[model samples]
Target: MFIQSQPADPAIHDKALRIANETLFIIRCLMREEEWGDYLREAYIIARRILEEKP
Candidate 1:
């Protein structure tokens, strides 16, 4: 038998989206740093993707 998945919780989903936005903001600030700029750029892309996705 196939298992069914529960519907997405709005609270949790909102919280996750908020966190992703915050992460993207922080990453954006750090991306300007000379040493870690490259790595932070990649991280920013990932966070941005998470923020853009729907539940």
Candidate 2:
């Protein structure tokens, strides 16, 4: 017997995609490590919290 996975809900997928894109943008900005030290640290913490809380 074989099992099949259910497709993701469109709304949830869109929300996850948006969050991922925003996180990627944050990471890109964070690559400028010198100028973004404290800001990057805060953003990282916030991102972590958001990801941890995600369903």
lDDT of each: 0.51, 0.51
lDDT of 2 by residue, 1-55 (tens): 1112433456644554566556657677546656455554455445444544546
Q: Write the per-residue lDDT of candidate 1 for residues 1-55, one digit (tens) a residue.
A: 1112433356644655565566666666655557454554455445445644676
In model 2, where do residues sit more than 4 Å from their true spots? 1-5, 30-55
Q: For model 1, what is the C-alpha lDDT against the true structure?
A: 0.51
Reference-based TM-score of each model: 0.40, 0.42
